[model samples]
Target: MTLAASDRGVVEPSGLMAHYEPRRPVDLGATLGHHRRGAGDPCFAVEGGSFWLTLRTVAGTATLRLSPTPSGVRAEAWGDGAGEALHSVPELLGEGDDWSELDVSAHPLLSDSAHRNPGLRLSRTGRVLDALAPAVIEQRITSVEAFRAWRVLVARHGEEAPGPGPARLRVSPTAAAWKRIPSWEWHRAGVDPGRAATVIRAAGVAAGLERTAVASRGGTDVWRRLRSVVGVGEWTAAETAQRAHGDPDAVSFGDYHLASTVGWALCGEPVDDDALAELLEPWRGQRQRVVRLVLASGFRPPRRGPRMTIQDHRTY
Candidate 1:
């Protein structure tokens, strides 16, 4: 469905409005999953069924408010980049996602999930830098630790979102801004050197990285380019691809808990990466989608031990 742009002098002062009609119901939760950093993410806010996102665009920082309408989703924006943000709203809402060939009829578990969440769509931000920074911070760390680091770093460096929105709505730092972050600040945010260096290197090539969002490049090529960076690897590339391109096949191989979780969900027993890969081989290009289904299947591995201990790198 094509996005319709209109100048509506309604609730928003900017009068900038855009809307899209989806072929199927749009699941706002699944589409906006990548935007929320944590319960306290300063860059994103959701209240009263309206979703707000602050992003840095080529034009400038823009804050977008998305609300559901009877037909589809409506978007309003305020800031210098309002037009750019509105232009990209369709992609962000998964307009380009096509899963028509996926056949889950034979697999009871996946078929059940597909039936349960028919509106689920993989969202694409088309902004690699935004996804990469958080993925880098999450490397080899607990989610709590990574979230804390993200909150601290973004709050310190990100700019306030334009308009009369909540004070907590802020735009993530530009790639240049990220590259300029000092070692001391990284330390303060509890980000280790390796991850910090990776982010910095990525920032240096931010423009090039954005090209990976092009659909024609394919997720494999994007993964290869992302992994060419010093500290980025299979896991980081997959995580980035999933968000930036809505890549269905980008399964995070080296994630600390994913293999076991997927294994148990699919086979009723914890399995290593190899086993998980073998089990998911049938879905090849749709592996990530299968993983998402498993996660949403309400099937979890039996907890036999304590959770991974949270480590505080700030003290180091």
Candidate 2:
């Protein structure tokens, strides 16, 4: 890969460029931004009119920059895995996502959301371990806690991305690197022992998990494989499957807020997981799509209680 320095003193890579025009309308940011651990995620960024992502691909670590164009999305990749990164752009941008199964006409809110955001589509990252690690960290914790732990750990342990992209951007640690993270580091990052153990266990068997993602048909196998990890469960597996394989039916069944969110939006009251399941029965094959549409509809359930307090494991 070729490198160049901008007059502003930031190094940037002038690497291979590729463009993909999706058959359906695509919202570049909404589709890819789902992978971001948080707004301040070290591995994902939005700067200078482009989206930058750093990930470990089959070939190696790569930094990818995506910019929206009139017709589609344009991409530039750097590092040993540049070609593979560029090649994965279409899938990353939801080129294979088919929205035909979503029956929005079942509700006016769903119909309106579908009409308003025709460009919204589910993205497939195809890196199961990368997706699973964060999901494990997020298990049973508030998103604020989970995102913070992910950011702190990745920034400290991950390698700097190979590109003239953002200086602070880093790819997630490799499976071995993840396994090597000491227990103290997890505590320092505000991660509890259970979540930490789960992540390490998943890393130890990363290859099998990734294979399950590849071998998955409609996401069942991937769900089973992910849940096989001790700390992983229905919610965590669904979260991983949604990103790693673009499984449209991967509803987060055990999420603290999801059932209430769906219940309030669809039933005019809060509901538990059972009620949420019953309400979503009409869209069995595409429950996640319905969830996404509900989220995009901007109907957050009213705060019925105090927000979850952030837990700091370092004190323990």
Candidate 3:
């Protein structure tokens, strides 16, 4: 299935295009979750089954409109970074991900989930800064609060997405722009000093951090580089790696709820990070993949307590 400009609307002549056919079935929406914050994320928008991604690249900012094809996915982009965006379509869609080493047969639950969602793939954006900024905001906070802070920051500092994409689309702030964000504005956006300071520090060394994406070093090496930043720890590095490089083994060790969730899904009871690690040791190199499958399995742990309350830092 080819995607022509006329299928959605008139395609701009200045835009670049690319297509990818995955070896396995592909789910475009699920694959692109790394770039989206929530339903109305300013940086990414979903119209029906199609995705509009506003990203900042080495070349500049670009907005990509991607639609799933029966064979794979098609990408269209406009702006200074159009070529870079088009070139990244395959990586963004998980076309090159190799799963032959993953054997779900050892665990019945995993096997069932893998069978149920064969199209599941780990997308790699190959841009560490993009993932790191948001991960910092998410540190020790509820997802709703983190998302709200992200939306506020992006809306205030990000540039309008170029081309004929959705009006709501905007490119995330550049590293310099991020560094320039005033402390007062950070407060207004409900961002605490810790997360805000981490983001600022990351922006200061954005280039060095971005290099980890294309480094010949292994995932462990990349994690080490990410962790060199003071506030970036196990959970933050794992979350960044998961999206920036499709790091299969980057288990979010310090996430507030992941250990319990994984334990409940696999053992029908909550467990600590140590127990979860031991349980997932057999699939050491593919732990993230296993976790994703479990999440897709619709096996929610029984709710035993009140959910984390959304704190309004802005009020303070």
Candidate 4:
């Protein structure tokens, strides 16, 4: 990777002479913007200037190390095959020719937020299966407990990330491994049997579903197909679609928070899915982008009567 142009006496055509940094995939959640408490994966980090970055499942976290290079950047990590995953980040983040031509505007979420990142690329990840599998396990449970349950299960049964650090990142259970989890294990994980069963069933054909999704209508259509699976619903499908393909149109069908977000952003009050769709009609193909921006921009309606009800099937 050589720069065709020169900057501040820096000669052109430098072999990958570019600034690089480690941007956590989970934190890069909102169009590579902010970081959040990763569900159960210890995937977080920041380091010195480096084009190359390394990541690892160290101590129950996705430990990432970014380093700068005279001509470029490099990174590395250890855990649950972190090396292989790191290699794919460039693809997942997407590359840019001119820093300004990223066309992030079309993606309303990334509009003003698109910093003049010198070079950016998306990492190709299949972690969606891992994240969503358990997320569904708690279906209507409290996120507080849900996240805790996820941390426990992932930290326990899942493989440690392949890296040089302590137990940071953990490999999400494989479909086969998920299948082996006993009923009692799920209970301890705070997951109800029904949702757990759904996750197991979905995992059984996850690969097939992913293939069908990309092969069929890309990510959006993939969610539709996934929703067709038994036990899979709109909220689950939307959540899955968002990560499955980094889709920008996946408006969670049952997102309790999103409707209000969109409603508050588009209108001056809270709303429902129908109204949310109507308000988002202008964005059409990019409703999700619009929604993300509204959320990131801090345009949500005031807390309307406490948040949505949190139910737990595990107790049932």
What is the alpha-carbon lDDT for the whole of candidate 2?
A: 0.83
Measured with C-alpha atoms, the lDDT of residue 278 in candidate 1 is 99
RMSD of candidates 1 onward, in order: 3.9, 6.2, 4.6, 7.0
TM-scores of all candidate predictions against the true structure? 0.93, 0.93, 0.93, 0.71
Model 1's C-alpha root-mean-square deviation from the true structure amounts to 3.9
User: Which lDDT tens digits does candidate 4 get at residues 1-316?
Assistant: 3222233212222121223333321223333322222433343433233222222222232334444444434445444444344444443343211223224566443465444332332223334565468548546766677777777776677765544443355556767788888888888877877888888888888677756533222354576667767888877776665544555566775675778777766567888888887877766655555565566664546765776566554575
**Residue 264's C-alpha lDDT in candidate 1?**
80
Candidate 4: deviation at residue 219, Å? 4.5
Give the CA lDDT, 0 to 100, for residue 103 in model 3.
93
Candidate 2 global TM-score: 0.93
lDDT (CA) for every model shown? Answer: 0.82, 0.83, 0.83, 0.53
Q: Output the better candidate (2/4) by lDDT.
A: 2
lDDT of candidate 2 over 1-316, digit per residue (tens): 3222123222232348866666678887768868888888999999988999987888899999999888777789899988778767767777557788677796988899899888888888789889999998998888898899999999888999997988889999999999999989999999888989999999999988888755342466677778889989888889999988888889999898999999999989999999999999999888888999898888888889777787777897
Q: How many residue pairs clash per model? A: 0, 3, 0, 57
